[model samples]
Target: MTAPEDLALYVHWPFCVSKCPYCDFNSHVRAEVDQAAWRDALLADLRHEVALLPGRRLRSVFFGGGTPSLMPPATVAAVLDAAVAAWTPAGDLEVTLEANPSSVEAARFADLARVGVNRVSLGMQSLDDDALRFLGRAHDAREGLAALDVAQRVFPRVSFDLIYALPGQAMRAWKAELARALAFGTEHLSLYQLTIEPGTRFATEAAAGRIVIPDGDTAADLFELTRAMTAAAGLPAYETSNHARPGAESRHNLAYWRYRDYAGIGPGAHGRRGRLATTRRRKPENWLTAVSRNGHGIEREDPLDPHTRAVEALLMGLRLTEGIDLDRIARLAGGEAPVDSRAVALLERQGLLARNGAHLRVTDAGALLLDGILGAVVRAQTAVAV
Candidate 1:
């Protein structure tokens, strides 16, 4: 379990040059932006969270976005400066920024690094030129690789994403691509299967039968292949979709999957602090307005009851290879463990779940069936808050 005083910070940058067809992240495209205004607003929002979450040590700060690389380096620096000043810094304080693998963004890497961004997660969604076009990415394979090379040189730690299980993608094709990706030798990789999310352009195409991803069986095969290959490459699956060498996992993301306290600022960022869940305004204009009036972009701050907190802990912690402690969940729930005893017995009998005293985790064979397992295991809550 994470200490209460250890905190992770997330700052959202909502502007993108263009939206990806498959993305549903809180991102927007606009013709113009007032960089100075945005920088000031973000600082104000950060200060607000800092005020509410005093006596904390900041461990990780993530600049996730529609495209955070688009932010002016000065803005990034200002936010980082204020954040570092607000909280006691952790010994291994990690600062990460997400970037699109484009020449324009790559050129800013050095400046960003100079301003305290030591890690970068590049959006090199595919390594094939044709696949890039199909995914509606602005950068071609050549540009993406060039940007990656620049990132590897500029940032102390680098991780990139790749989308597999594209429509008509063959297992052999994905294997070759995965081989190329692993050979890049980055300490971390986020390999994701292509899914048609609701409201994404891909969803519309699927609805019209104009596109179809791999069947469930084929996708499962691909998932297994990815896990085996990455594990063999020495960057094993630390989480369901993220793989990293030992001691190289993303600290900010790990804070979330481990169900730790984090503060979120800027447009559409969500944070968990103590017993409260916080969310910011999703639209850029609205967020700015909120900041101007209230000094924070928070749209909601809801207190989470014990049962809700335990269920959330289970849902997130089970995503990691190292599972949760039943005792921990019980403490969070302020009662018994939130899981059904009978369900655990049945899943354990089926070899899908494992238990070692108070520790419980989903087995490798059950990883793909995690959704089903979670549905079965988390018991419905009826206890009233005391």
Candidate 2:
């Protein structure tokens, strides 16, 4: 289905059962939460934000986390209800929730599905028991599969995540995991590389040379293998780290990659509307208080320049196999993309990028070198404009 024009909503649930050592998201583990109070605060904040973007048809609503599945299903339903009440929903609008796989969560699948969440993306980071433990995941392979089974039975569409390119991972091992995951008959899959972001335990360990991750070259090779295997399985990378069968791509995520307008609600959430951008308060309690006191909890707001928007679009869109749509970029930028013709030409010669009519796409080789290519392309554009 085609995306509805120009709008989506992101509802952030910034609480988790426990924090993973490698995670650096705006999530916290707390012994208790006042669900009713939280429900009221988030609903108020969301309605206020919706007031700001009135008349926009919302195409999708994503309940992203800490661990959204941990939220009481009643609270989840309340947010979903508030979303529809606040805006117009397009045909086949998708409501998605991010959850972690565990038998406990599996039991809640039916409850979530009943509350307008027709899509469920569960975090099943690895199928190997050892890998799961190493990643500090709470579930074992059996529990993960059990949860997936429950999610598939309850939801119309189900997606699960897996992480590859771990330390000491080999091509054969990764391929085996991919094959097994595909065998689960999931319509959508997310295979991500293990990134050691600063402030994460993984990064701290790596810095002291106590932990070892795969080298850059090895990671690149594993990435290529992932693409080939997924494509062969009839699932292509519609966006970076996401693979899905035709018509199964996440609409909510597509809303982000397409650079459409979306409202972010919840602690530490970010929102963009045309050129104006806003970030919500990062602390849950503070957010609730601000919303109660002033009808909203926005902490920072600014308008981005056209060039910055274009650069963001390029950064996000190139991750898709279909690459950047020139028309969309032009419409958003209010002018043509400021890409350097010479840089694109050089990339074409290097088999890193290919021009297709009005769009520019990264080749298989280009996807392999995306980290470097993005920097080079941005610098070339800067130099050419100068």
Per TM-score, the best of the predicted structures is 1
Model 2 agreement with the true structure over 1-386: per-residue lDDT tens digits: 55435588898899988778789999988899999998998898898888888877878889998999988899989988888877888778898999999887788889898888999999999999999988999999999988998898899999999998888888899989999999988999999999888898888889999778889899988988888889999888887789999999998888778777899999989988778888999988888888889888899999897777877888888878888876676565657675766788899999999998788988888988887777766532343232
Q: How displaced is residue 380 in candidate 2, in Å?
A: 7.6
Model 2 quality (TM-score): 0.95
Specify the poorest-scoring 10-residue window by lDDT in model 1: 377-386
- Writing each residue's lDDT as its tens digit, candidate 1 over 10-73 gives 9999999998899999999999999999999999999999999998899999999999999999
Model 2 misplaced stretches (Cα beyond 4 Å): 1-4, 379-386
CA lDDT for candidate 1: 0.94
Best by lDDT: 1
The lDDT of model 2 is 0.86
Q: How well does candidate 2 score on lDDT at residue 150?
A: 89
Q: Each model's TM-score, in the order given?
A: 0.98, 0.95
Model 1 clashing-pair count:
0
